[model samples]
Target: MMSPIASLTLSISDNATPYYLQLREQILAAIREKRVSPEDKLPSSRSLANMLGVSRSVVTQTYDQLVAEGVLVSKPKRGIFIANTSLITMPLESLPEAKSAEPEKTVGYFDSSADHSVFPHKAWAASMRRAWLNPDPKILMGNYRLGFPQLKEQLAKFLYSLRGLECGAEQIIITAGNRDALQLLQHMLKKHVNQWYTENPTYPPINASLTGQLEHLDVQLGGALPPENTSPWAAVITPCRQYPLGISYSSQCREKWLQTLSEKQGFVIEDDYDNEFIFHGRPVTTLFQAAKHRVSAEERVFYVGSFSKTLFRGLRLSYVVVPKAFVKPVLESQKQLGQSASLPMQPALSDFMASGAFYRHLNKMRRHYRMKRDYLESLLNAHLSQWFEWEKPTAGMHILLRLKTPYADDPEISGFLKSYAMTQGLQLSLLEDHYVDPMLATKGIVLGFSNTSENDMECWVNVISQCLGCYFDG
Candidate 1:
């Protein structure tokens, strides 16, 4: 058999990259693909240079760099060889097929995400650069078990200004996102709480994240209050605006829920996600704010908020305002599990918030999304009224269009519509998919308007009309 080095199809292409780098990549690829194993002998710089018709200096540079990176071993007096390092092995058979050159057709996706076109890239870049140039010693040392202190301080200020929530930096824990916050709460509270409860038509990921027996509270029949039991329980609630349904909990509902939690010694995970996007009216009082004055309120409530919906989702930054008593345990659990939210972006986000860029971005998105929401409502009224009826949402990014006529096969119909919509370059979400129990799900479609453009909205609305005609007329 040919030597492993000789078998590698190394070539110096006429590209921007240097010849030495090109040869280095080809050799690395061979090792990664397992064509060359650890401890395999490599040809000397002179021999490789002669074989490839390149200068000895180029080969020597490549070898020296690889040896420094521990990819190659320079054994004194012996020939150079591949180092016995833990290089990843990607077998040739398992390699993915090369992507086609043709660009994919753009699809009008109605998912709950911020408009990517409006992201404040310049402002964010400035904040990132500032943070990098004047790095905080706490962030650089990675000493923040709870979170970057400056970010926690800024978040506390922002939350107090936005929602009248009284909290301190010590009570806040930076998480990857809402799901990460929920998972951390589950870990910390699993022993004390007997059962977990969520709204019936809740965010599906909430149900997926919690372990142990989970029960659903009905939102329609004024069953927002959990059942009173001797055993202490925990609940995950979206109080500012219910997901999919877009209904805010009334003052009476909030009071009743808090009373039940207090009497039963239960805990609540208040998910105040996307409340900043409220369009028409004044912002509603948060569950955390409502429970703050209650006896032992600090121990009974955990407030969760995230930037994924308000800002771009890729930020992957969320925070949980935990009870004062549980802060140390949660931080300890985070230490054991490893930090979920990355450290580099935390300081940058702190700068963004402190400099008032975050508030400005929120104000801009609120206006932009409100206009999109109204435009979509008008299109649905003009075109899809006969088959569907929807109440215009005052908060959150999406609207739920309930079917005019209840069908027993609603799930199947919605699933079929989702598949059909994808073929026509329009993405749709099934309202039924949001329910914990499929049997309790309402027949509807949830359309996200925040990310959809006016032109795409009109185009997709007509396509949706055509889709409905196929379903109803046939």
Candidate 2:
């Protein structure tokens, strides 16, 4: 789960005069626009105060003003509620139109939808200062064309401890981010490999880059088609957590992957994005675990990971741990393409990991996101149980909801749901939206809870639940 405030939402600029008044105004606007209608008790005073980094009195004063204005009402036992007043009944004429006539910019690339204001700037600033004050500039300046030696070494050790793997510094090839790794990997292997296999309901960017020839698989359901016969030259999979579907590939299924790859001459690209954020029971084993059991004649297994899911997206750092055989070609491709991440920042990243700051920060974020995940999960159980079937992911940032519908085609339903999600500030992918085949497109919407706050979660989920009413009974 992501801190709603950390998603770069609700900016507070220097020109935001009368801070408390600004916060109050924002709240009123949401209420006026029916974004938060009557009976919608805003986040608790303490929570909102913390969210805005203001004194409790400030919130109290604003609440008092709304109460006096008859826009909000407080009950004896039940906390504050939006008053069912004329203001609530009146149409948009009473309220001013949205601030700009210009349509709001779409949240596309570089638009994380993260509440970045919640970032621990003070702490990060301290880390940056510490790095600058240190005597060793080589860590910052020296170019390890083979990628940052220190970061790779630290990551290798960390992976060994965390995921039970044996990796050397030489096996790790650090790059700008996951996209960079994908592009580089494709460039390196495209000639040798023509087809790329992916889960039917996978991430969009992954499908987009593969020239739209994604292999659609129906997750880990007991009775389904095994991908072994596909004979894909290469496959990219999220074994730990399937995006949107929130399904984890079963141990048997993982073994099946290894078995299939052994029989065929292909490799599996294991994308362990958000691998450390597991919530239920012990974290699952990595695809690398299966890799150790069976080494194909072609050495068909490559491991990839990124830091964007755990830390902020701006980090723009990801790495691939390639098999020894592919190392030469991958490095050659990187050199030809100038595909290296921030050379200097690698040491800072290394220092962050070596000093245990990475783990420390991860533990803190895990705790925070766990709370958010749990809260959202509880809300879903309470209100959406009838409409959706979902399994809580053992790890990862988002969840998949299987919606029941009378429609025979899944892609149509997926598109319908996707349109609704986008309207309410949600950027979600439909289960079948990434499929190359229309038969694979009819599924459910993938909800990303990482970037939304607990306060907004309830409101948005309510809207979605209502929209799902048409299909809920089916």
Candidate 3:
């Protein structure tokens, strides 16, 4: 029988794509179209290269890649043949049109994300370079499962200087981000606790991550601690700056929670996200700090902090400071399940903190975000004041605007606004979605100003005004 290679037709063009890739695609297409069958022999690289009028290396490269992908098989001294395995059975004609290379344009996106334009790129790059050039032996060997010790040490100091919370480096476990930290905590505590509580109108992801029977503590009711009960439970609190509302837990409220948890043998996951972005006065006292002084035994507060808000969301680095008792078990859990946070960036982050670049970046962002918040507030006040009411947030990235007119079907109105905003390339979030029970949610909209520029904010505010006007007028 004639070799299958003689029957096959392959060609390449001098287009933008590389020669080897084009050849590879042609071979893949032939295989998918059933022009080649399994176990059919093909000519050697040199023979195929001569037939195709391309270099031998190009054929070799294409064959090697197809072999790696299991689309082709090589039997020693025999020849290359199509593998029995199928390649993406879907027909090429059915595939959707390719997306454009340029990103889609948006008028505004009011998201609680760090302003990438203001990131300290030069300093971060320098830190990354230093980390790679003089990497610690432990980091290279991947010995520390809990976290890189240098990063934990710097974070320990950072907590002390910023929040007056004292913790040993051994007690901190590095995580991918807030969700990772919460999932870890949930895994660790699920065996001991039967119930979990979170603030009503909390960060939606927090509710999604925690397991077991979950309940909400009403933030409108002062977010007080649950009644003194013997059953062990865990509550996730954003004391530094509550999500959506942007209100800090008062000192008295913090004390009550710590005292209740100490007595009830419960735990509190203190999500201290965005604590560094306090626009006005010093940051509020942390629940972790209060727990440290009050509870002598295993500290009841699990303090979770992330660089996503302060640095950039793409960094995917966060840490949870557990009690002294949890250090060993948490490390064991980390070893069993594998560390989720990327190890390579840990050393660079340690260097960034040590070289004072992290702090400098924080200071710069504080001023930048504060100015943005002020600008957004002014626009809202100037254009939408007649229809909306809001208290200017002293800290954090977002502002909650309550509609002055109470609608019987508030959620419908919120849904309408959100959908209309999307039509104009402006993303808007509904306050109702934050609550566990949508019926109890307040009538408001949440706007994040950190990532939106002043001009964009003004444009978005006007768009919101038009959306509301249309809703009421119609």
Candidate 4:
């Protein structure tokens, strides 16, 4: 019989992440969240292995690894119990050796994780150094399913100051990144939500994430927001700056979005992907504030913001401000998922934001990205104006050049150009590729201009133009 303490959820993926490591993360998360308390017994390795449908060896290895880390303790002829480590600062170098090999790093052609040239290495490192040296061991590892308290408090302030959104620290739940944020929401709300609505031409992976768990419904975007014939449980949208299209959602559009949520008492997952990148226009009214009169502030919107686009993707730090009602449920789901991001870095980042270093970094990057955006736009307009049509994006790291290709509906040319561009080491996303119905997908390639330096911009664009020239001028 499975013990009452054996309520561990282990979702095994047949990916590079080994099974033992996944088990370790789950147990650690449970401990940190206090879902499993100190002196509480854990299921025997044999029982856990059988429950999880894996080899008993896997569970034993995971338990042993945790024991070595001082996260768990064992008693002879008894069972494993959560360690009473009020604070744990086990040095990585002191841990038992693991069998996994370090993975190699690779850059994508469209990589926009961070501006490699301008990252505040010294500032970030200085903050982290202070956090690491703190005498409190809890800072090293505490179960913050909602996120480090310091980070949440600081982030709540940061969001209000920058985006004009208002919420308290309790409302903010930090996950590894947007992906984890969505997964946690899915885990918590799938029972209540039957369908998750998204924009038609959204990044494909956003829909891909909900596959199997819930149906993803794409509402075609155009001049006006469409009315929902049937109410959805919730909608995930990048309203401020719709992905790839670079168009901002109008007030009328926002009204419709709010209406759908109000009718169903559903929620909106607002992905503020390019929250700070707008080069023109006033900040779009946050979906949260827009819905305040119609519904309570917390019930209407789920504000999803990621440091990936704003700070650095590698940071894997993103925040979601849930409605007050959903806070406890989301945290419970996070505990079950055993999601633990780097604890030391969260507070360090919180300090970075509190000290205003984050804003400083953003100010610097905005100017840098603006200059890059201008250079890329100028190059494309000068050389390839006849072949493409596009608007200057008010904000974002990439611009979608809607191809005015002579062969309108033919995928052959667009497909060939995409394949050929790769040979020249140019990485880009086709706008058409993001659409659910291929016919509705627009023609053009999405260009991410953030990574290329000014000196390299002309060379890379010239090569890309020549690549397009072969197809167009042919």
lDDT of 2: 0.66
Q: Could you tell me how far off, in angstroms, the CA of residue 133 lies in candidate 2 after the best superposition?
A: 3.8
> For candidate 2, lDDT tens digit of each residue in 199-275?
66567788775654555566545212246544447777887766645567777777677777778656678788877
TM-score of 3: 0.78
Q: For every model in order, what is the number of clashing pairs?
A: 0, 16, 0, 0
Better of 1 and 4 by TM-score: 1
Off by over 4 Å in 3: 1-108, 227-229, 407-411
TM-score on alpha carbons, each prediction: 0.78, 0.69, 0.78, 0.76
Please write out the lDDT profile of model 3 over residues 137-216, one tens digit for every residue. 77645566778889999999998987788889988888877887888888887677878888888889888877767877
| Residue 94 shift from truth in candidate 1, angstroms | 15
Global fold similarity of model 4 (TM-score): 0.76
Per-model C-alpha lDDT, please? 0.79, 0.66, 0.78, 0.72
Kindly indicate the candidate among 3 and 4 with the higher lDDT. Answer: 3
Better of 1 and 2 by TM-score: 1
The Cα error of candidate 3 at residue 327, in Å, is: 0.6
